[model samples]
Target: MGLLTERGELEAERLTPAGERILRAASTLFYERGIRTVGVDAIADAAEVTKKTLYDRFGSKDRLIAAYLEQRNRVWHAFLDDQLAALAPQTPADVILALFAALTDWMAESRRGCGFINASVELAAPDHPAMPVIVAQKQWMRSEFMAQAALGGFADVQELADRLLLLHEGALVCFRVAAMEYAPEVAHRAAADLLAGWPRD
Candidate 1:
């Protein structure tokens, strides 16, 4: 059977220590070095496994790239979930601004802007195996933001989501461009003001 399929590869019966090691190494290598830059040989050496073993387990470099992106998607969602959980019984302004706070905290220790964003830039090919993973992740994030906006009592949840998404992404770009740490705070305030001026439900 061809390795690339819509459902993705079957889960192995059991993962060996080496398999786990390979995943761990891939996690670091793929995030630190761009996926295109980190070849199978690099992954094998870092995991102390043979290239054949890597292929036997994952089928191909493309599959491994999908796996790596799936792993990262889970991590990014988990971070957003954690933030949402902290703000349960959500208030309008606080919940909205909390996202900004979360972004601020994330940027301070993130070391780089975002693994998914960085990887997407490197994988310019539209049909790359990792592209669906990126699109799915981003759609999920937008959904989460809309859900939060609803919880915060906004009549225009989608609009708020769009605005917040723009501001949030803008803060990341500004942070990268300006090499400044305060952009998130400013964005958060601006977001709060936008919400405040809106006609309330």
Candidate 2:
């Protein structure tokens, strides 16, 4: 079984028109209002579909949550890809720093912080259908950092990636949870300095 289907959930791409509407509504509601608080009823009301349609499309609220997160992962990657293309980083180091630079703009509109982090907090159960999606989202970031570090011939790629991920995630939390409005700027500067002083092969 596929990762999503291990729990018997429908994939996000096979949505019908009504399914699309349901997912669109769920994604907005889940992000705007916490996932735990929003119900299938609200999603159905927002999508203007019956609860049965929502179930038929997603199979369960848990599955819908997974699809919401999967959709978010795609959106985030696309945004980052656009940023990277626009930045046109000349070196691997530039690529790494560009990621930190992108974070400031990415969080400009939302005060809720990282959606994956928020979802992880709410879906504490390790076996939850959406847990893998949340974990994969984060792992992807770390892997990107590690890949860039390796490409740059930086020593200790694993450690470097870990440190970068820490700063990246910390800034996200501080921005929302601690109300550090300039948290992303702080992270960017920290990443730049870290890269500058980092050991080369």
Candidate 3:
């Protein structure tokens, strides 16, 4: 979704004012509530536009979902970049580990859990319009982890990244499903242990 651009906020020139409002309304409602549970009418009402306007702008609810997801991915990536800049992590290991803190902040902001994961569960169709956006978000996260592992001088960077990605996703699930506030902390500790044993060469 956001892999294409650094601009994720609604102000990006890609959408018209009304279109942006529609997407913004859908993003909040869909995340706060389930995507399927919130219909086009509700989104239109929330955005203060007619349902015809929504269909004309987005074409359909499925496409709207994709747009919303793309907007969210862009916002999330922008946030991570900001956080990374603020931390000024000296090493790849520091950057990777520091992502846990970022995740914790994200979790607090998004009490319902990962929006991509939630949409996947609700949509249930691999061929849905939003699937590409969802897949892009995951692929970007995994690839970033791999790049970080390589930067950290891990000999088995691919395998290390695979494990780290697993832990990262698992923590998101655990936090959402089990409602565990410390899931990211546990995942970070586990990642630290794994990194400790990996060959640095």
For residues 26-139, write the lDDT of model 3, one tens digit per residue. Answer: 999999989989999999999999999999998999989988988888788878888777777787888788776688788888889899999989988889999988888887
Candidate 2 global lDDT? 0.88
Across residues 112-199, which tens digit of lDDT does each residue of candidate 1 receive? 6667677788888889887888777666556656776676677788887788788877787777667767888888888888878765
lDDT of 2 by residue, 105-191 (tens): 999977688999999999999999999898877887888889889989999999999999999999999998999989999999999
Quantify all predictions' global Cα lDDT against the true fold: 0.73, 0.88, 0.84
- Per lDDT, the best of the predicted structures is 2
Cα deviation at 1, candidate 3, in Å, is: 16
Task: Kindly report which residue stretches of model 2 are placed more than 4 angstroms away from their true locations once superposed.
Answer: 1-12
In model 2, pairs of residues that clash are none
Segments in model 1 whose C-alpha atoms lie over 4 Å from true places:
1-15, 84-89
- Per-structure clash totals for the candidates: 0, 0, 0
Off by over 4 Å in 3: 1-13
Highest TM-score scorer: 2
Question: Would you list the rank order by TM-score, best first?
Answer: 2, 3, 1
